[model samples]
Target: MGEPLATKHDVFQAIADPTRRKLLKLLAEEEMPVTVISGHFPMSRTAVSKHLRILSEAGLVRERRVGRENRFRLDPQPLQEIKQWYAYFERFWENKMAALQYLVESDEPVKPEQ
Candidate 1:
């Protein structure tokens, strides 16, 4: 078995930019043309296109050509890997939160303020 091919555009890199993340949210509900997607951001359509390219390379977004127009939609499958990666750390935070709750709800009642 050979190692996986190295690609600069991974899920992390794809979503690293705020603009790309917004693009994902916009496409989450429905697929839209590149021109429409570009409207949501302050940047130029060409800049939006660049973000879309990164997203497509990372497997986070899928693009389909409808005649002369290109439609983009969220794939979401790649995001599962990111969710799973962060899930491992959730337990630590949960534990800390539980401990804080216990301290706040201790049996010893708080003294009346003087």
Candidate 2:
């Protein structure tokens, strides 16, 4: 393994709110200013800011103040923990499928159609 994944605090904080998840999806495409993020939600800028703050604390989003605007971007590395966890299930399912295939093939009779 490379480095340890993000702590529970990070993952929980990142996924605590639906707004944050939406923000993450948007940021995943490209970085945008606070205004752009607020445009997508019905909440106020302050509410969005709070969501962003939570995401930042979770190490999922990075914010930089450029002049008078705050630009927010996604930090995807933290999500690798989730991916790794899911990959474990993927392998388990794959092995089960292979075993099932072997069993089915082994039980098939090699009889010609008569």
Candidate 3:
């Protein structure tokens, strides 16, 4: 059998940049051409497009040609990986919070020991 397919980009790495994260948030609102998307950012359109390209490679953003321009929109399915990753750590936080609550609400006398 042929080797398994490889991803062109890693979602984690793709979203590591603040600029790319802003791009994702902007696209989440509505699909827009690169020009419109670039308007919301302080950087050059080329820089914004580069960020969008990384997002597209990671499958977090979908792009399609419409008329003479490319429109981009958020495809949040890939973000499930990030959510699932955070969920693992969430359990640990919950456990810690529960323990803290128990300590705070316990009837045991407060004692200071060196």
Candidate 4:
């Protein structure tokens, strides 16, 4: 099995914060300049910039300078790692839910055919 990801730049860490997650959602819709991205949140531009920096470090977003306009866009490739990691546990949840369903159905009395 692959080892767990444990680092500041891990995609999981990048998305852990609500602000960062919102930033990713915004960028996913369309690429935008840092100014526009910072506008979406109520926080100061500097705070948004910090969140962007973390997302950049995690490889979830890419930045480029276009004639003084620093634009950001979602990369999305890194998020696959996070999804794959969670899929393992999702199976466990599914099995538990299936068992609970069986118990509930069993508790209901059966009706005879007319």
Question: Which numbered prediction scores highest in TM-score against the true structure?
Answer: 3
Query: Model 1, 53-94: lDDT tens per residue?
Result: 888888888889999999999888778768998999988867
- Candidate order by TM-score, decreasing, is 3, 4, 1, 2
Looking at candidate 3, the ten consecutive residues that score lowest on lDDT are 1-10
Candidate 4 global lDDT: 0.83
Candidate 2 lDDT, tens digit per residue, 1-114? Answer: 865343335665578678888999999998889998999999898999888887777778888999999999998877876788889998876786575543334666644424
lDDT of 4 by residue, 1-114 (tens): 453333358787788899999999999999899899999999999999999988998888889999999999988878889889999998986786575543334656543323
Best by lDDT: 3
Off by over 4 Å in 1: 1-8, 100-114
Each model's C-alpha lDDT? 0.83, 0.79, 0.85, 0.83
Model 3 clashing residue pairs (backbone): none
Please identify which of the two predictions, 1 or 2, would achieve the higher TM-score against the true structure: 1
Q: Which of the predicted structures, 2 or 3, would earn the higher lDDT when compared with the native? A: 3
Q: Which parts of model 3 are misplaced by more than 4 Å?
A: 1-6, 102-114
How far is 67's C-alpha from truth in model 3 (Å)?
A: 1.9
What are the TM-scores, per candidate, against the unseen true structure?
0.77, 0.70, 0.79, 0.78
In TM-score terms, candidate 4 sits at: 0.78
Candidate 3: tens digits of C-alpha lDDT, residues 1-114? 442123378989999999999988889999999999999999999999998888888888889998999999998887888999999998986786575543434687644332
